[model samples]
Target chain A: DTAVSQTPKYLVTQMGNDKSIKCEQNLGHDTMYWYKQDSKKFLKIMFSYNNKELIINETVPNRFSPKSPDKAHLNLHINSLELGDSAVYFCASSQWGGGAGMETQYFGPGTRLLVL
Target chain B: EDQVTQSPEALRLQEGESSSLNCSYTVSGLRGLFWYRQDPGKGPEFLFTLYSAGEEKEKERLKATLTKKESFLHITAPKPEDSATYLCAVCGTSGSRLTFGEGTQLTVNP
Candidate 1:
């Protein structure tokens, strides 16, 4: 079974439309994250949630929102999509470790979004 | 701000040829370092984790080594299927989030 999985591996929509990407992890991790890999192959963290609590929100546009229903699921919703939003979105999860603890992220096969 | 830089944005090596990719980071308190491989149109696959300096780990033809300020991913006698992007990430103990570098694109031609 896939440790982490995302739905709609490919999403194509017109500009100004809205979309949501769902992510789930079977690893029973307490932390989940959404990362964006742009056309340039630059991967950056968009948001992070720990035990369904918002923990890290990067300098992303307000149009991007993340909702974590539980420790094993985190979803990313986008509003008023733009052409620049065309990129690969990845979902990742890791077991929580305190100070001096080890953390390894397991990523899902990304969702490719294309805004026309 | 935590910063990570990867060198030689791209590398092309023939089958059986070996090379190393570099990942340098400047974080306040480095908790751990990670290496990942990403095939096109797919997500990143975790490869190795380096916790501190002088640490080394290997998997098949790949070896990961950590230093005080940077990490290295060395591929030995790579094959064509080894072509993919290698990513490096660093997490700071002082902070809970992970900061990632752009990634190094490697192409192993058969």
Candidate 2:
């Protein structure tokens, strides 16, 4: 069974188009995250939701928004996408507690978005 | 500011060759340090989590050790299947988010 899964493994869209990437995790984790890996392979966190509550919001542009209907699902919606948004978007989940080895995160098989 | 930097961005080794990868970080308060291995077209697989200095964990041919300011992932007799991009990330007391390094890509040839 796939622990974490994402839709639209490869997405190619034109500029100014809006797109959404869906993510779901079966690990029953409380924390979910959205990361963007640019062409330089630098992974940066964009947003994080803990138990469906917004926890971490980085310095991302306003065009990008993340919605978590519940703890098991997190979706990212990009509005009026630009060429600079072309990168690999990854979804990750984790269960954090006051203990050792509980901070490990399991990631989904990323969604590659290409804005032409 | 919190940051994680990995050295020797890419390395190529023959089968059975042994080497070590470095993960250096600068954070205000350290919560945990994590190591992950990522294959092409797939997500990252969790490997180890080091909480404090002098802590060590090993699996198969890989051993991870943590220090005050850095961590090392040592690989011995690595095979082709062990080749992947190793990522290091850290979480501090200020937040639950992780700051990730640029990752080191290792390639082992049989």
Candidate 3:
């Protein structure tokens, strides 16, 4: 079974439109995160939710928002999507935060979002 | 700012040959360093986690070693299937808000 899963593996949309991507983890991890990988393959963290609590929020556009219904799910919603938003968005989860950078993060298969 | 950089953007290797990939980082504190493998059109798969300087971890044909500011992933006797992009990430004291490198793509020709 897949540890982390994201829906709509391939999402093709248009600019100025709105879209949402969903992620779920079956690892029983307490923290779920959202990361965006650009054309350069630079993977950057967007948001992280710990036990359904927002823990980390990186420098992301205001058009992007993350919602965590519970510990097992984290969803990303984008408004007024721009062409620059075309990239692979990955969802990840970890069991606990070491607060000292000692934990391993598990990543999902990633959702390829294409804005045309 | 915290950053991770991997060298040799791409590598072409002959089967049964061995080599090492590098991952250098600039962060505030030394938390933990991670190693992952990514095939095309897929997410990264975890391989090893090194906690402190001089720590090492190994699995199958891959071995990971970490220092204060960098880490190295050594692939021994690599096979054709071992070809993939090796990604390194760092998560410091705050959380596993990992910062990933551009990744090193390895292509092993049998």
What DockQ does every candidate get? 0.62, 0.58, 0.69
How are the candidates ranked when ordered by DockQ, highest leading? 3, 1, 2
Between candidates 1 and 3, name the one with more favorable TM-score.
3
TM-score of 2: 0.96
Note the residue pairs that clash in candidate 3: A99-B93, A100-B93, A101-B32, A101-B92, A101-B93
| Runs off by more than 4 Å, candidate 1 | A99-102
Residue-by-residue lDDT tens digits, candidate 1, B8-98: 8999999999999999999888888989999988999999988889999999999999999999999999999999999998888666777
What would the per-residue lDDT of candidate 2 be over residues B1-110, giving only the tens digit for each residue?
77999988999999999999999999888988999998987888989989999999999999999999999999999999999999999988766677889999999999
Task: Evaluate all candidate structures by whole-model CA lDDT and list the values in order.
Answer: 0.90, 0.91, 0.89
lDDT of 3 by residue, A42-111 (tens): 8888998888998888889899999999999999999999999999999989886534435567889999
Point out the higher-scoring one by lDDT: 2 or 3: 2
C-alpha lDDT of candidate 3 relative to the true structure: 0.89
Model 3's CAPRI class is: medium
TM-score of each: 0.94, 0.96, 0.95
Residue lDDT tens for model 3, B4-66: 999989999999999999999988776778888999999888898888999999999999999
Docking quality of model 1: it rates as: medium
Put down candidate 2 lDDT per residue, A1-116, tens digits, no spaces.
Answer: 88989998999999999999999999989888899998767888898888898887899999999999999999999999999999999999889553222467889999999999
Least lDDT summed over 10 consecutive residues: which range in candidate 2 chain A?
A96-105
